[model samples]
Structures are given as structure tokens and as C-alpha cells.
Target: MTVRVRLFAGAAEAIGQDEVTLADVTTLGDLVARLVADFGSGVAPVLDRCSFLVDGVRAADAETRVTGTVDVLPPFAGG
Candidate 1:
């Protein structure tokens, strides 16, 4: 399967881009592995602090199956 990823905040900075298209990423865990493998160490920490929305639905766990668009959102601060 192919998944389109949208990165925000630190995730985008770490990966050096806000959007990416990945193949064979069947689950959230698989997507993380692929990002770490493709982008190296910089992305891991950012990913760790992030939450994911798969097709606008919150992903409950790394094992959550992913398709369509996956949004990577780092912790946001506002007042």
C-alpha cells in the first residue's frame, strides 16, 4: 500500500519536508520505521513526541493500519 504523509512542526523540520509519499507502509509502525530508515536519526525523536491522524482519525497505536493521508503532529503550544 501507499501512504501520503503530512508532517508538522518538529516532524517536518526533522524530515526536511512537510509532505512525503511512502510505499509498502501497511501500519503506523511500518511508517515510522521507514521514516527512520530513510531520513536517519533526526526524525526518531520528533516522531516519538508526535501524534498521528490517519485519514483524519486519531491512530490509537503504532500497530494501527494506515492508508490515504497520515498527519504527523508534534506537541503544540498555545495560550
Candidate 2:
């Protein structure tokens, strides 16, 4: 299924966009891996410190499935 990935603050700046539509991802982990492969260093470092909200609930686990929007938030972001 397709998932919407939203980036905040430094993460968004690094990727040069706030949101991306990704396909063939089932878990947050899968999304991370894809981001790293697609964006490389530009996004990898940001991912290291990023926290996530999947469908509006905090995604504390990497295995959280991406059935809807996944917001990638960094600390002190989006002021």
C-alpha cells in the first residue's frame, strides 16, 4: 500500500520537501530504509533523531505499520 510521509524542521529541509508519497511499505522501518536509500546522508542523520506519528498516534515502535500518514518530527521543530 501507499503511505504518506511528512517531514518536519530539519528533516523537511534536508529532503527539500515536507511530504512524500511512498509505495510498497508496510512498516515505519521499511519507510526509514527507503528514505535512507533514496535520500542518503541528506535524510539519514535526520532519521536518527526523528520521532514519528502514524495516523496521529505516537509511533514508538519501528514496526508500526504505515497505513496512513506518518509524520516525522524532530525535537523543537515547527515552531
Could you say which candidate leads in TM-score?
1
Q: Per-residue lDDT tens digits of candidate 1, residues 11-62?
A: 9999999999999999999999999999997789889999999999999999
Error of 1 at 20 (Å): 0.3
Residue pairs in collision within model 1: none
Which ten-residue region of model 1 has the weakest summed lDDT?
41-50
Residues 35-57, candidate 2, lDDT per residue (tens digit)?
A: 98888866888888888999999
Report the Cα lDDT for candidate 1. Answer: 0.96
In candidate 2, stretches whose alpha carbon ends up further than 4 angstroms from where it belongs are 77-79
For all predictions, the C-alpha RMSD in Å is 0.6, 2.0
RMSD of 1: 0.6
